[model samples]
Target: MALLETRDLTKEFGGLRALDRVNIAVERGELVSLIGPNGSGKSTLINTITGMLEPTAGDITYAGTDLVGMKPFEIAQLGVGRSFQTASIFPELTVSENVEVAAFAAEHDSFSVNFFRRRDAYDEVRERTDHILETIELDAKAEETAEALPYGDKRRLEVAIGLATGPDLMFMDEPTAGMSPGETEMTVSLIRELLEDWGMTIFLVEHDMDVIFDVSDRIFTLHEGQVIARGPPEEIRDDPAVREAYLGGEEA
Candidate 1:
């Protein structure tokens, strides 16, 4: 069954149509990659689906619920999560504390009770935070400051923060953006583990064809704000239009 579906999705910024009548679907437990050159609407489609940008026309449905008018937080609460292209976290906070804070805020969004709430009140969040740290292989660094970790570990911490949300489906924008080859390999393995071990579906926006081709079950190609091609990895690798547009006429 389709875990997420978008029908005739369109988004406009004034006179610019960033996404033009695009339709895509992700089945549960599949790792789907969305690839396109810059300005081809990859990020625009992710933003629209994740509620950062409202679509001008069309429908977005997740787990059978329409997400057309939902807020980002609401979508997150509904088991959708995202990690930005850049690593986002508090440098001053400890690694465990970073996930703990996100977990606590996710559980209680209201700020009115902050003054009376006790640290002991967040027992559940604390437990989950530890589990997330372990899952992301950062448990050994739990007491270290976020900024003190190596660059690759910091990236993993950001993934930990997203995992703390307990999402069934995740949108990752360039998860291996600035990693070294070894780090990239580790991250790739981590993403695969999310599918095999955690039973999560992923919709990834990435520039690295090696990473995309290595991990994605299916690939979607976007060009000039429209979905140009989509199919299995081998089919996408052999697509002529994909070569002319994004691949620069080179074979994958």
Candidate 2:
């Protein structure tokens, strides 16, 4: 069975539909990309799948079970982790501390309430945090405040925090947004390492064609709130329909 699947999922804002009859299936250990122009409902679909936005129609399934009516954290507790387009790290906290918070969540402990309890027992969280930092190549900035780190590093910290959730499926809204050429290349490499070496399944939405083509095992294109085409990189590249929607002229 597919690890994550959505069937005819939709969310409507008044009469305007954000998503309409979208069906997507992500296999375990696959890096799938959702690609489309702005207002194509990529973010809206992500929010609906994560339960942050209520769907007006349809259902989502993870691990062969229905995900309808589940709360956001409830979905997380069920092993779905996600990062938003905006960096979601704690600006005031150090990078290590930011990941530690997510580690506590994975272990089902309260970082907020247990902030001061068992200070000596935090070696595990610290170690795990360090591992994630190293994997993302942010170990040198572990002590730096999240707000002080570079934008790309901040996004890496966001990914680290998402990893700390210990999820079977992760959704990254845009892993390469606002990055320099070098940083974008580095971020793509990091994603490949994380999925190929560390064994995390990722469903990420991105506008960067390079990142999408480099990372995605499968690509799904959205237009007017529906999936218009989906296939491997080669097929998608050759698909005239996809090109029409993505690169074709709409101007008169």
Candidate 3:
């Protein structure tokens, strides 16, 4: 079975449909990308699958278990994790603290019970946090405040926070947004490490055509709340429907 599967998933807001009977799957150890123009339901699909929004209809399964009705934390506990389009880090906190918090949340179900404890009290959480920082090349700045870092580093910190959750499948939403060329290259390398070295399965939504084409094993193109095309990168780049809908009828 696929690691994650959505069968005919649909979501609507009043009279309008945000997602219309969408079907997609991600196998283990693959980097699958979802591409679409703004308002094409890319965010909606991620929110629905990750339990941030309830689906209006259809089935979502992760590791063969129904995901509908599960809370966001409930889904996280099942080994799913995500990073946002914008950098979603706690600016005031030190970089290490941010990662420790995520690792702590993943290890303990009840925050009320352990929330007041000293962060150092949890040896495993600290170790995992340290490991993630090293892996993401943020250990050198571990003690710096998140707000003090450069924009690209802030985004990398967000990815590290997601990694601290120990996910088998990760959903990354535009991890390279607002980055310089050099920063984007760094993030791409990190993503490649996550897939190749750590053996992670990723579902990504991104606007950067270069990054998408370079990293994705398969690409799904959405137009007007439905998938218009899906194929390998070369095929997606040349697809007539994708060209018309997303690429301005020009080559990507």
Residue-by-residue lDDT tens digits, candidate 3, 1-252: 999999999999998899999999889999999998888899999999999999999999999999999999899888899974334578899999999987777767645556447566588788888888988899999999999999899999989998988988999989999999999999999999999999999999999999999999999999878999999999999999987886573333
Q: Which portions of model 3 miss their true places by more than 4 Å?
A: 85-88, 110-121, 247-252
Q: In the order shown, what is each candidate's alpha-carbon RMSD?
A: 2.9, 2.6, 2.7
Q: State the weakest 10-residue window (summed lDDT) of model 1.
A: 109-118
TM-score of 3: 0.93
Give the best candidate by lDDT. Answer: 3
For this target, which candidate reaches the highest TM-score against the unseen true structure? 3
Clashes of 1: 0
The true-versus-predicted C-alpha distance at residue 25 of model 3, in Å, is 1.0
Q: Which digits, one per residue and each the tens of the lDDT, describe model 2 over residues 112-155?
A: 55544766647877888888889899999999888998888888
User: Superposing every Cα of model 1 onto the true structure, what RMSD results?
Assistant: 2.9
lDDT by residue for model 1 (48-166), tens: 99899999999999999999999998999889998743246988999999998778767775343772376665787788888778777899999999889998998888888888878
Candidates ranked by lDDT, best first? 3, 1, 2
